[model samples]
Target chain A: MELKKPAMAGTTESSDVMITLRPNPEGGIVIDLKSDVKALFGDAIEKTILEVLKEFQVENALVNVVDKGALDFVIRARMQCAVCRAAEIQFDWGKEDAHGK
Target chain B: MANELMRTSLYAGGTSPVKMIQAGFYNEDCLVYDLEDSVSAGEKDAARFLVYNAVKYQRPAGKYILIRVNGIYSQELDEDLEAAVRAQPDAIRIPKVEYAEEVKRIDEKVTAIEQKAGLPVGGVKFWCNIESYLGVLSAQQIATASPRVVAMALGAEDFTASMSAQRTKPGWEIFYARNAILMACRAAGISAQDAVFSDINDPEGLKKDLEMTRALGFDGKTCVHPRQIDAVNGCFTPSPKEIRNAQRVLEALEEAARNHTGVCVLDGGMVDKPMELRARTTLAKAAAAGIKVGGVK
Candidate 1:
């Protein structure tokens, strides 16, 4: 899905990740991640976000992630919400897997 | 049958990941992931996604989980039901339920979703929130509206607001609604959950209110804060004296059965069917609370 507008989801609360998605029409997904645990779980967090974007077919977007040590499911949920909002569509539970498997 | 010891059903805001992650660690019997009043209007979608993933993937074990959706008339109800049904919590609590028709509609919608998702059609259950005078009057019908209805809770704040009455600490204003909901639940053989105490800091007030809640025969109580769970669970647990009496009642029945007599007597009183049933329920409650009752499982 193509991004129609810039959108963001989640808060910077403890055990949460705030994600900002902006439309990047030129192509290629760009990620800017800020996390205290970047040395340990940074790659894992980036992989989770990229997987969600791939599942939604969102190829061209600028992803900004501020991680507060969120779990995998929390990260996936926030990413899904951000993608849906940026694409200007309602969430379709049938098309999306909440479990992120 | 539902969990026998559902003394406390604690609400965890769906938008708060920290609360959701920590909610299961509490001793509350049920964890309610709330997507309704606790969430802001713009964050409804976010809350739904968060709750869906929380329940579907990271669900906590051994606790009855419920997801409170928006009201039936709200625009978010459809999508909320879609995600909630697929997420597969123990039940979906519909807020501000006032009529049987609304439940029937939700029941049908849930059935369709379950079928589409290939889940058991009746595996999902309902917990209706009766928050209006119309809801109070239609309690019986709502309790019996669908076979999936496992419990009905009184939303005292909204009920009092609907009646144009002030809500006081004593809670006399909601007395009738409480009894109405309890009677409907009893008649329908489902759990009757009481409203939240709403005074998190006042344990004394919560205890006093819980006295009435237990006296009114509510099966459980909704809790807004984690600190209230222990109090609610303690209030609902069977006392030792009650447990001993239940044991005596069962022993008396056993003795009568061994003697080949139809009449069972205990402590100068007849142990009738209703009394025996209450005794068994008490013993069952004790057992669930991890209290050992002699000669009873």
Candidate 2:
């Protein structure tokens, strides 16, 4: 299910997450995301993780991904983070602390 | 790869040890079964449970038990790993280790499971199959991240597809990936295993390929069929001469210990260090082969 759909019962917007990815020169990829809540629904989360992997172009590279919360914006940010990590380019996306700049 | 460290390992290809046993492969020592591939799509859960139950009992002949879980990135991977944690086979095989983070994720998952299961943690080992192109790329980081990792393996069939080198032998086409992975495993102090030779009928071909793999730095090869085990065993097992050398090393070391000398010289150099390890491992392997050694057989 799309993270942005109306919050299902017992669902919290804060529980959703979005990921960004980028290239890393270490012959791998990296990921960044926002997961305000730690409600890891196991299998459900795997669907999204796999999707993000598609963009990383998983060739000769290492990947690092971080999670925040459920936000479409967060997903984009995660992708961006992955790119930076894969490229060995570091960017701050901590929502404000020298990141998100 | 003949110069590569040789270890004997077996595969079940996602089947239960029982199935392997029923098929006559499990009774042989040094055999292992996979919990991830080969099983029908629907039977994974049941097969996993069966494997777990089987682990509660001793495997056929002190066989080295290994469970290959689905790629950790899969939707069911976490669950599969969790099931295995409680089962605690000899080792947990992480399929498609595409990056360092995946290995870290596996390490963390295994740790949490060990703690939650109330099992004294830290004994389960990792067997990472560097199958995909991405897996090969991150092979170094992945192999070294987990302290529990005992070895890394190649998944040529899938990797061939990924690299579009399908059905081609001259693996040197992916020579860089192969060398890099082998080097990584060596740097990490773990065994590097090779995947199965699919053509079961071509025993000669299989033997030839293994010679290359052994030369390339693989400790052992994974087998898809039971018939292939003999060749794998033959390739990896310590030869009579090597065993004799190991026994010699052990005896020399023992005499030094008996003399109360912390260490002694051997082969015209400091034989203290390598001699001890080689001696013990030799003893262990000899024991595995039913040969008795001083104080350990």
Candidate 3:
């Protein structure tokens, strides 16, 4: 799905991550991440962000994440929220995507 | 068809893992991860995902985990059910349930999810929140609507608001509706849970309400805060004296049954069928509450 506007999700609470997304017409994903635990989990956190974006097949967006020791699931949820909001779509896990076929 | 004592079912918002984890560790009989009313519209998706993962991963042991999904009419109901069923909590509580068909439909959706996930069919159960006049009137049908429904909780605040009434400490305003719900659940042979006592700071007020519900034969009470758990559990837990009396009655009844007699005597009083049933129920409640009854090692 194509992005319709800038969108964000998640909270700044402990063990949560706030993700913001903007439409990028460049047709590829760009990520800028900030985390307090960057020294130890930087690469792993970035990997999770990319994997979540790839799962949604989001290829054209500028994704920025501010992490606060969020677990993998929190990151996944926040990113999914950001993508859906930016694309102006509902993230109904009930629906089958093209990939489900 | 004995109902378990869910002494406390604590409600926590889906987005707040901090609060949820606190509730889980508090040893309430059940922990309700709420996505309805508690989460803002924009954050529903995030809350669903968070609650799903929490149920799947961080579920506190020894507590029944339940998720309160959005109401049947909400646009988010399908996805909430989709996420909740996959996570596989003990049950999904349906808010604002007014019709029996609503439960049947959600049951169908849960069944489909179970099939798709290869879990046991009918593994998840439902707890209907009866909040409106229509719901209270049809409570019996809603209670017996599906075998999957194990409990019915009254949403008193919303119910009073619907009737254009206000809450009082003595609870006279809601006495009839409350009793009606209790009768409906009792008739259907399911658990009846009392509504929350919103004033968390007033232990005396909560105790008064709990006493009323207990006297009315409610199985438990829903809690909005962790501190309320101890008080709720206390009201439901059988005292040692109560347990001992129950044990004595059972023992006397056993002796009479051995002799094939129609009547029994305990403490110079007749021990009949109704008394025996009450005694048995008391012991069952004690056991369910994890209390050490006499002669039970």
Best candidate, lDDT: 1
lDDT of 3 by residue, A20-70 (tens): 999998778888988999999989988988887777777788988889888
lDDT per residue for candidate 3 within B1-297, as digits (tens), equals: 212458789899998756766676786888889999899987788898889878776777788889999989889998898889888788899999988988988889888878876679888889999998889888989999899999999998988888898887888888888898899888888888998899989999998888898899898889888889999998888888888888999888778888998878999999888888888788888889877666632
* Candidate 3 Cα outliers beyond 4 Å, as residue runs: A1-4, A23-30, A92-101, B1-5, B116-118, B259-261, B294-297
Stretches of candidate 1 above 4 Å error?
Answer: A97-101, B1-4, B260-263
Docking class of 1: medium
Better of 1 and 3 by DockQ: 1
lDDT (tens digit, per residue) of candidate 1 on B1-297? 344467789999989999999998999998999999999999999999999999988998888999999989999999999999988889999999999999999999999999888789999899999999999999999999999999999999999999999999999999999999999999999999999999799999999999999888898999989999999999889998898888888889889998999888888889999988989988877888888777753
Question: Tens digit of lDDT per residue, candidate 2, span B1-297?
Answer: 011123555665433333444542432334455667776765455445445434433344445677778767666677677767666676888887888887887888888877766667887888888888898888888887878888888888788888887555555655666787889998898887877678879888887888787677566777776777777777666677878777777667777788999767667767767567866766665555555555422
Which window of ten consecutive residues has the lowest lDDT sum in model 3 chain B?
A: B1-10
Candidate 2 lDDT for residue B154? 86
Models ranked on TM-score: 1, 3, 2
Which residue pairs collide, candidate 1?
A: none
User: Interface root mean square deviation of every model, in Å?
Assistant: 1.3, 19.3, 3.2
Please give the range of 10 consecutive residues that has the lowest summed lDDT in model 1 chain B: B1-10
